[model samples]
Target: MSQSVAARPRSLWRDRNFLTMWSGQALSQFGEQITGLAIPVLAVLLLHATEFEVGLLNAAGVAAFLVVGLPAGAWIDRMRKRHVMIWADAVRAVALATVPVLWWLGWLDIWHLIAVALVFGIATVFFDVSYQSIVPSLVPAAQIPEANGKLESTQQLAGIAGPAIGGWLIGILTAPLAVLATVGTYIASFIALCLTRDTEVVAPRDEHEPLLRSIGEGLRWVFGNRYLRRIVGTTGVSNLFSTISFTMLPIFILRDLGLSPEAMGVIFSLGAIGGLLGAMATPHIVRWIGEGRAIPVSAIGFSVIGLFLPVAALAPAVAFPLLVAQSFVASFTVLLYNIVQVSFRQRITPKRLLGRMNASVRFCVWGVMPLAALAAGGLGAWLGVVPTMWIGAIGGLVSAAFVVFGPFWAMRELPAALEEADADASR
Candidate 1:
């Protein structure tokens, strides 16, 4: 029998390279959270952007995945993933710094914000793709779940703290200057990347293969596989509704509910604790119930509990608690689903195809976000914020059907590799 993650004697915390990567990622995630909160607040307060405009800005931030995601995977596969990540961080730092400079010079506007968000998004696509590819190289395969859990926990912690600090900074320093915090974190992450030493074993390349063909190979690999296809379908539909709800959340809390920035930050921070808890509990849950079974259960919980978000707007007295409850439940379920699935994806894929495989999945999953954001914006403007929330919530709940009724429900544990999966299919 295969050794479980808990039975492994070696700890990830002692690995120097992993620690360096972890520190940088933690700082970076915190910075990202800060900027995540600050950007919408800036658009809402400084430029007085309409709901559609805010949605457009959100759309611009993730639109690069649809544009360059596939080619980026192909390119990263040919180069050192660490170098790609470091450069991506530097580019993002510089792109984000432009906002404060523009704001200080009185040249900042909604258009400038959109342009910066687009640039930052492009850089983020490369960074995230590289980040995912590099982690497997830095640690043993048995420890991947633990490594991912730790990294995800840090991200969740950042989600908890970054917003509170960002809200405080926004209240005092104003939204534009609050962005500088992100710049600092990116710089810190860059230095951490520079310090880390890992010997990358590059996959043998076919120099004659065209980039488009390589991308197509990845698409085929993902879509041709039954397991990956189901994951993609569920995640794609879930992300579409998630973007809709999250895009409108700030508008609901700030404009409709008339909550202060600090209060908003606190609500988000408290809600984020669920993610941290989920990350911590994932391994135990997997060990207890088995990995494949965890996915559908988490999906169900994610769908049912997310309905509370839209309901929060209905009651003024309970809005704060309701939002917090919704956030915790939503974050927990999503993290639980993500850690297990990502680990399974990494294990089943060949190292040569890792970057492309990840990129392909991200393309399918995240590609819908921009369109969804725009749709949410349009819906929010026409139907009002509360009604838009209902649409998103109901849509999110329906997304669970994709998993519950699919092949995943029959899976108890994931297949060890693609070959095993294929063999099973043939039977």
Candidate 2:
């Protein structure tokens, strides 16, 4: 029996439900990559948007994380996560499809783009929260790490191809037309998710439970733990400043640097290679340094590398390579930190609280993005691009202190809770 058990391959490859989700996610991520570039490109090049206008557009895309993120988590825990995912995908497809239509009608404006982004972002909050929460239901505890790596690896691959494709498509068909391509990818994802089978066993809940109470429970659970709370604070602070810097990229790169769409695509695609390598190398890094130690190291490394973004402005001739280099190193470090922390969080949380847990985390880490986008717009206008970037670079560096001085420095193994859960799953 032991030999037979050992002979069988232990992998998620044989799990149809997991495969279905992965396939859909891969396609969706590819389309999202296009949207990531296309929208900003459209707002910058086509609409001739200023720094403040671009910041508003960027802010719209992420504001939902703060507005509806908490409630979405509470609702997700009470419903089938897969069902929520399918609906969210469908909504995103519909919302994105409008960009091309409005443009064709000569009605496209920055406001239209912002409105679409806001709606799409709202759906994304639900989809993303459910997506992460559903993973435990798809695979066992021991498989969580492998599943995260695979998912992150493929997402990075999409990051590699999506920008290049989006740029080429924008050059040939125009920015609005490029959106249609993203719409198609989302439709494909919607169909794939419709076919996915979910095995989540919903826990009994009082239907009358106040949504605020549920949200509060998740909030308390995440905040009650010192380690988790610090991680949240670190990520939240880092993301705020990172957005301040990134919000200026489209304006500065296209206008100040005079780079073409094709060059822009190549830069982003090549830069994402760092994330791919990081995801692939995460297991090895964790094994060598352990999770707790890796967190602070990765966090500090990325923050330090982020300073390079501003350095590129000093020498215009080498700006392109410098920009790509900064992106590469930053992405690599963020991925290593993210995959390790996410897998650790997944393993430790109980199944019933996964939705709220993931949601609460997102609320802290991602919630700052929109606010930062607005801040980026104002600061970019007031302080000028390089000065604002300097502010972000300096501010972001401080986030590393949270992990470097926290409890994880001494934690070389899983806490007792996660270890017990892993043992239970093996049986």
Candidate 3:
């Protein structure tokens, strides 16, 4: 264990196996960040896709969470999660690398880009399910929040740097070739995954049983639990509303505001700095405010404050600042919310059901996000960009009410007392 990890007793970072896992995850996140920009640029610049087509590309990615998430989760529950993650990363690297290769061969096209997107999306579903499921075995319950916080921080840092780098590469090398940088990140991720060692853990036995029954059991556990239920509901609604605005932000900036691609990259990267700060601070905030209250408070604030993005139309000079501010608040709030939710789920779920449980909830929460994106795009085409944004902002505020009206708002703290209660219940 490293000295920093050792300083924090009972922390996951102190565990050698989890340290390896976190390092691998962090490395992979860098590549994941580049893809968010590179892939879209490929579609828009190289393939000459339309606005609806761009929306379709995003929708296709989210399709995996809907179509394959449940079954993939169940399948992963029967396998070695670490290996699953490694293979997933490897597949993604190869798929992303194909873009550059095909471009060189003069074979790059919109359909090919879409195919790669779908494949990458499927791989992500598998990796995410495995990663979430395996966290419990990597650390003690007390360390889950800290582990989640650290992971969130790493992801935020990737968000901060990846787009800027991608934009720079695109400016110099073109969009297709810039994807090679993303591929390099995936390669690094794969290498890190190879170095990681995991302590042996048991797989779920329910895979051999009726598939529907097994899936149902996992769903029941997540939804039946009061805490998880509230989390799923709150996040799902918030995600739906947030997706509306997020889906159109790029279009608004690049098309409506006439910002250069480089400027868009800089804006995203700068805003991500706030995300990094938020993720770094999340553990402290949780400790101070308690997980229960802190988590929902951030969610509400993120959604409500998101409304201010449209105010940027008042002046183009302030547009970047407004966008950055929205990104800052939303990223911070979402990261904090994820920290609490992921840690709680890992702590409460049994190892046997972790994969399915993680997937089931994610499916419910994120499956609708793509459709929301499509709706945003269609609306943006029909109504103007500003009007579409207005709709999104209103929807986001209303979605925050899910948390406000729920029992999540009533729980002002999470402490050793709740831990003891969980211990007693588990026994």
Candidate 4:
């Protein structure tokens, strides 16, 4: 263990390749957050879209996970991840830039926005699958937790600035011009990716293998493993309910509460600080409580905090603080859950299977988001926003039971290696 520890890279900050990749991803994540706010606000304000339309728009943006997620993993496994990422970024940049250009031409419409969201989401699916697959090669296995923590921290930090700035931009420049910021960020991300170099060679694969067979291999590997199966259940259920709540959050905050765009931005920004804190604390928490234990605890904690969202509807004065508190605590626990889970997935999976494994996991986790958004939208349209949120929050709280009752909760510690875990399982 000592020798293994000694062989690991001590500091990610000192590595130029990692830094370049991290910088590009940081900018890209921040850009995504900006668009996240700007797009929905644009739909509501400029297009005068109904709650169901807004939900549909959000669903369209993430629908690619269900569309191309499986094949993307198989295809990416056969190519250089860095090159795939670079092209993905370039494509997304061009796609997003069209939005602002069309708006400036006074030809922007809901269909145009929908087209852009779908195209951008397709690029994002490739980028995300490649990104997760490449990280383990960039750092040693022992350092994965630290690396993931740092990456999560960067994401949280971007979440802090992105929405707040997006909100302010939307307030001053309106939603159309606000999207231009993401265009610049994507361009910057492209440049950052261009500067980095990947030292690892692409993993070898059979040239004649059928694509369907390759995809099936990934699916079998993920579902065949007990640990991953439980993770899928936990993540899928939680994401389903979380998306339901968030799908209508814009209407609740901006329309129902009558909050200004800037104020709404501030609320989200302040809430993201909890995520940053969680990232900073993860390594210590893992050491203290063990990784296996942390998962259920975080999941349950997040659910408990989520209960506050529906309660926040009592009054405007009561709503602001309670909503902020809910966001803060929920973000914190979610980050903690994600950091450990992602690290564990990376650590356990072999290099040749990383892309497929990540993709399969995402397929289960994110594919449900669009469905949940549509459900929430339909419910919000029929039952009203607050009632929809109530169902979402309660459903999310209950989903934690999947983890609490699963194999993960029974283990005191995660196995040190996948082979050892497999051996124990077989015995």
Candidate 2's residue-wise lDDT over 1-427, tens digit each?
8988976646788888889889989999999999888998999999988889989999999999999899889999999999999899889999999999999999999999999989999999999999898888888777888999999999999989989998999999998989888888888888888888877987667553688998998887787667677789889999999999999988878888999887888889998999999999998988998878989989998889888888889999999999999888987899999898888778787877788999999988899999999999999889888888888899999999999998788977656485554453344
Q: For model 4, how does the per-residue alpha-carbon lDDT over 274-372 read when each residue is reduced to its tens digit?
A: 999999988788888888988989989897887788888876688988988988999999999999888888887778778888899999899999899
| lDDT (C-alpha, whole model) for all candidates | 0.88, 0.88, 0.77, 0.86
Quote the RMSD, in angstroms, for model 3.
3.5
* lDDT-superior candidate, 2 or 4: 2
- Estimated TM-score per prediction? 0.95, 0.95, 0.91, 0.95
Clashing residue pairs found in predicted model 2: none
- Please report how far candidate 3 places residue 334 from its true position, in Å: 1.2
Clashes counted in candidate 2 amount to 0
lDDT of 1 by residue, 31-71 (tens): 99889889989998789999999899999999999999999
**Model 4 error, position 82 (Å):** 1.1
How would you encode candidate 3's per-residue C-alpha lDDT over 110-165 as one tens digit per residue? 88887888899999999888888776666666666677777788899988988898
How badly does each model clash, as a count of residue pairs? 0, 0, 0, 0
How well does candidate 1 match the true structure in TM-score terms? 0.95
Off by over 4 Å in 2: 3-9, 204-208, 416-427
